[model samples]
Target: MDPAVARNLKRRVAAALHRQISDEQRATATDPDQAGLRQRGRALIEEEVARWSEDYSLAHGVPPTREQDRALAEAVYDLLFRAGRLQPYLDDPEVENIVANGCDDVWISRADEPLRRVPPIAESDDELVELLQDLARRHGGGERLLSTAHPTLALRLEGGMRLQALMAVTPRPYVAIRRHRVASATLGDMVRLGAVDATLAAFLAACIRARKNVMVTGTQGVGKTSLLRALAAEIPPHERIGTLETEYELWLHELGRLHQVVPMEAREGNGERGPDGRAAGEISIGDLIPHALRMTLNRIIVGEVRSSEVVPMLRVMTNGEGGSMCTLHARTPHMIVDRIAELCLEYGPRMTDALAYRLTANALDFVVHLTMVDETGVGGRRHRFVSHVLEVAGLGEGGRPAMNEVFAPRDGEPRGVPRTPPSCLDDLRRAGFDPRLLDSPHGSWSAPLQLQVDGRGPGRRPDPHANGREGGAR
Candidate 1:
């Protein structure tokens, strides 16, 4: 077929589809049938494809092959019902993230591959920004906008894809789409993924079942959210779980038929500051925490804690029912206490460091620290693993959080070992977990503290994972 004729046919088909969609919407305005509208739109696109393909074949003195027909249908369908130029990457199961750096330069991160460049998703920056704005309008409740006035848009699409865009805030319009790779994860599935060994998986599952307060700590893209989801699955089906997040990233409501889930997302005000210089109608995790608590929930899950919400989260974990979980960014397991203190002071109540330590010690029970290592030789991908599981022991000298190293990574091994007994021995047993697993010397691996390079030991050297491996995986 001729390229000029093909372009003309595409434009004509798109225009026809637009008109048909408008007509369908108008017809359905009084019906309140959303499924019917979608079905009509789909049928219209298909009928147009078949008619146009046949017309082109007859006029060009050639019959269209199966592949050509299929291609035409897909192209038309993308323009009609899907993200125009970015549909292919969205359909790929392995693509974990799609990053658009302006319009001409696009990149993607696959499950087992390094970040690599991809074909442009748009013809120009203006087109890219328009695409994002359209998405926000259609699927995101039309509350957020991407323009010089708002300059930022963040929302979850209908397909559960999390999108964040920056317009005038940056030199160029930037967009990022983070897809949840593991839609429905379980502890057993995570074990198969090499995220955690069978022992750790079993223990974490038991912890959840026993209604222990837990926090997953890690840097960015280290599978903290993944582990948190896997752990959340251990809660009994009869339990009512409430999840709160800045964006609805957990998708906990989709956790099958057994559990009752209440999902809440923080609403960003329309960038309107009132007389007090604060955005009016802005709702924070702090606001949602009390609301979730009043819902008679058996458990509460915060997708991630980034600010003053830590204060309310700690209060809930301590005073509210057990089994509350959240994730945060921290470099190491030991540093998480300090990290919580810093975030609380910055965003939450203006409390002294001593009060922060005391509150954490009383509220949080365990911290599961995760790390990602560049294992090109092993898997040709960055492998995220649980590096430490610390039990909060009372405040130690200088009001620092004292912790018991229950699980820590050892030399020459990817998984960490159980170094100490769990504080909740009776609870684990009641939850059907064998306490003997914690009693066994974990593979004869040396304790994490003793493995330090500067520590005195017979022939122990520094563990590379512990020594300045920051930014190892993104």
Candidate 2:
């Protein structure tokens, strides 16, 4: 027998025995050798019984008893399936992200906090690819593995989960699975987790409701899109929301319209790229801008602005609705402004950096940023919304939006610059925003953000899904 398998059995039996027998009582038992033998033997018996149940189910059509069913599940789990290389952590809900540095090690994040190694999920490059494909197929409908010919692929899973895989021409193949689950959420959840205060969260909710063109920026695995969606979830029921992305993401209230538009980048050899000479006959996000307008959307939400789509997105949001939200990739808040400005110039090369900044500054009303601690950081760090809310006060002379260090929850309390003039707030006021909302605490403010709040879906509402609400997310 493989030593690993035998040792795993020993460890599992010992653990089960410990749970079944009290330490003090076990110490008092006579014939210690026989007692120890019996404990492990009984554990093995139970373990085998569970394993047999699973095997029986696989062989026959019958379901096992609830006890037998659970044991069978554990036995199957202990069988060392291909996904097992990562071990117990893979099954742990607290872990939010898993990263493969190479073949021998895997890392994960807990509670917007730190990355810690549990175990590797594969033995070699090939095994890792297999697990990657399996995960992709499970989360996404399916996936394609490629070499230099295909290069890279990114798709949003069926539930708006994001997955990206890249194949190399030189180095080894690399795969990353970014989990979208957040352990702590809700206004109260945020306050308890030290992410944002009720006040700041309420302010953010207000920002979303008013239809501010907001962008969330964060490093990889920092929960940028999650924060954006948390805010977007507040969009009133009456609005028609059309979301464009490479995957299906950006959910809204059940009563509102949710249209998922997947924009696939044209590939080479497939002869997809056109005159642009980039994105392989690319249907640039610029290509998708006109499509959103065609939808007559009340608001547009882009997953993340990683490319020149930044320019077209800005143009669309500025021209379309006064209230929209998007996410951007950046290490910091200021970097987000610069990235957006740089991307805009891709579409309008004649536009100066100053003009680009002004466009982003004016086009965006606020900023929210998240950061995940590097694994090397002391005491192992985690990802958190470090810069929760930033008020974009237009472009400074240097072509960066003057970031107003507004009230961010410090130790769950509002910190940073105090209230500034309400140019953005004034727009909401003009739109008939509730006047009494500003004075409420973080969790209680219920101001509505919509050009006009709708309490129903788009003519045809899908029936409420069973087991629909996961955690607290609606």
Tens digit of lDDT per residue, candidate 1, span 334-372? Answer: 789889999889753558898889989998889999987
- Compared with the true structure, model 2 gives a TM-score of 0.64
- Give the residue spans of candidate 2 off by over 4 A: 1-91, 112-114, 131-145, 156-161, 183-189, 253-284, 371-383, 386-388, 394-403, 408-421, 427-474
Q: What is candidate 2's lDDT per residue for 308-395, written digit by digit as tens? A: 7777777776787767777777876557766776677776668778777877776877777765434334333442544545777876
Cα RMSD of all models vs. native, in order, equals 6.1, 17.0
Question: After best superposition, candidate 1 residue 366: deviation in angstroms?
Answer: 0.4
- Candidates in order, TM-scores: namely 0.83, 0.64
lDDT of candidates 1 onward, in order: 0.76, 0.56
What lDDT is obtained when candidate 2 is compared to the true structure? 0.56
